[model samples]
Target: MLLQGGAFSACNLAIIENRRLPGWICNAAPSGRLGRAHSSRVMSVATGEQMSKPHAPTHQPSLANRLRLGSLADDGLSYKEKFIVRCYEVGINKTATVETIANLLQEIGCNHAQSVGFSTDGFATTLSMRQLHLIWVTARMHIEIYKYPAWSDVIEIETWCQSEGRIGTRRDWILKNYANGEVIGRATSKWVMMNQDTRRLQKVTDDVRDEVLFYCPKELRLAFPEKNNASLKKIAKLDEAAAYSRAGLVPRRSDLDMNQHVNNVAYIGWVLESMPQEIIDSHELQTITLDYKRECQHDDIVDSLTSPESAMTESVSELQGSNGSPTSANSENDCLQFLHLLRLSSDGSEINRCRTEWRKKPAKR
Candidate 1:
């Protein structure tokens, strides 16, 4: 279902007509030929969604690393290190389509990483989808939910990078029909380059930049902006008080990633961890937007603040109005809040600044 908000109050969101999604393709056979017979429909990236797999994990979080020495199960494939990551199973949602995010990843040429975080917005407009589809995210692109008209629940996603870069790259995904040959969705992504040592943003070099030009389309390979600011920035201080109204600690070496900066998505872990499990279970987000002002480095102390102003209505429960305490204020009204996340380096340097907004809806139960 489309976002139910009415006109003027609604966000203008467009998705490919459902008929445009891919049908299905059989598994690759032992001979290594793709699609012994091509389907009647040729789904294009601009028109449809496609569909795959992730890594073996350790209890320890991972850091970014250079090409490794044949550690990936040496089954002897030509492109071991460059294998496409598939969506074995993703909780991808339809309210926010997966195709939109794939396109975002396609914009960044490879040798890049997912740099910023993204979520649905509070104030919707032409700029809403444009910012998400055309820009880098500050956090991990999550699969909220995915389903098509014909299927029960076999959503497949295939993710791959065209090439690697010092920090940026071209990436794309195919959302496919698991049992048949169909392209249900598609995604294009872009990445940001960074200083591996300082974890600061870095300009891509001519050699590395030129290499990405091959896989990137003309529009996808636009001139890189120093930052993703909608307007020129006014300097905000790195002070402790202005920092936030809560805090979290990062005491792990693995908290660092290949770029030497904390991986962009790691902060989400911090945010969710700070909130109660009941809050997550009760709320369905209307929209969430993230802006990454700086990077959190190794051993940095990440501070967080959940403002009473941005609090979600569902997060609070009140006594039945009749027996209310005399000093009690109305809890149901004005329960929304703004969350401030302040991450700092071990040396007390402000590393990342973020603001998260939430709206609360009552639990159906």
Candidate 2:
């Protein structure tokens, strides 16, 4: 379904066709027979979306030191990270896709810890030194998108540690265009640590505080309130009654991260894949809020479902497209509000749920 808005508002937006950014592949030999990068490649420092993995308690690390020990400072400190926008990072609209933006936000937050010697490996090593292991999990994420950059648009993203509560740590981000330095997006996220052995929630220990407090900024860049379960709408289970649904997407090897599970960003792409092609061609995403419930493994077959807020009106008269299909083409009344759910096909366990808002694409001049 297309975003059914009353009027197509104008915004300062630019477009570029998705194309790979200019860069040379490193000539260094692949790390081992398994083809892992043990030595640092001389390539540009893009966001760690492709590198960082969500560590799961069920598996052992196959790739060691992907999180560099050198990246962290002895005295924990956070710093701004720069990322050159890439072609694959953008969507059909030629702007940064929501998944790419979310990945950048996630990377900056994690890299802040990595830079402060709190990487996944670093944390495991630190806790193991004391006979404990904790896995960092993103509990809640809220993102606000003011603008999106096109392919090859260099952007700087800054993330910093906020305060830690009983079980959660807060992180925030500020994104700006590299050329003009215009603020494009800001986000806030909440993370909680889980004990690897017990499979239960763990409190932020003094060790965690000691490492992260040194980098916590006094003032936040964005004034986003801390999010809890009560603040957001709950997602309902979708059965055969759902309007739009897509299925039969199996997790690929490329989809699995170092954690041996599907990456969180992959869930966003799966939800979007269920979106109607007509809606995709005529609309642009505005904002999306995702609540991850469970981790999906490599052997799982996932399904995406969306329930549109507005039901399709039965008519074949005026809302017809060039092809004999009901469409909101060129109509000011085009907007979409979706409640999305992604789940396993076998037992129907929900993996993640999201709420998304879309606006009609402005007409080209």
Name the top TM-score candidate: 2
lDDT of 1 by residue, 1-365 (tens): 01100111111122111222211211111221212221122233323533211111112211322232111111111111122223431223323222333322222212112111111231111132223322222321222112231213343444444333554443444444455534433333334543333445554465445423422334422111224321122223334443233455673676554335554445545644555444455443322223455666575676654333322333212222221211112244423344444455344554444333333533232
Pick out the ten consecutive residues of candidate 2 with the lowest summed lDDT.
1-10
Reference-based lDDT, each prediction: 0.32, 0.54
Per-candidate TM-score against the hidden true structure: 0.40, 0.66
RMSD of each: 17.8, 16.1
Number of colliding residue pairs in model 2: 7
Best by lDDT: 2
Candidate 2: TM-score? 0.66
Instruction: Give the Cα error of residue 48 in candidate 1, in Å.
Output: 32
Cα-based lDDT at residue 32, candidate 1: 14
Each prediction's number of clashing residue pairs = 80, 7
Error of 2 at 186 (Å): 1.8
Model 1 lDDT on a 0 to 1 scale: 0.32
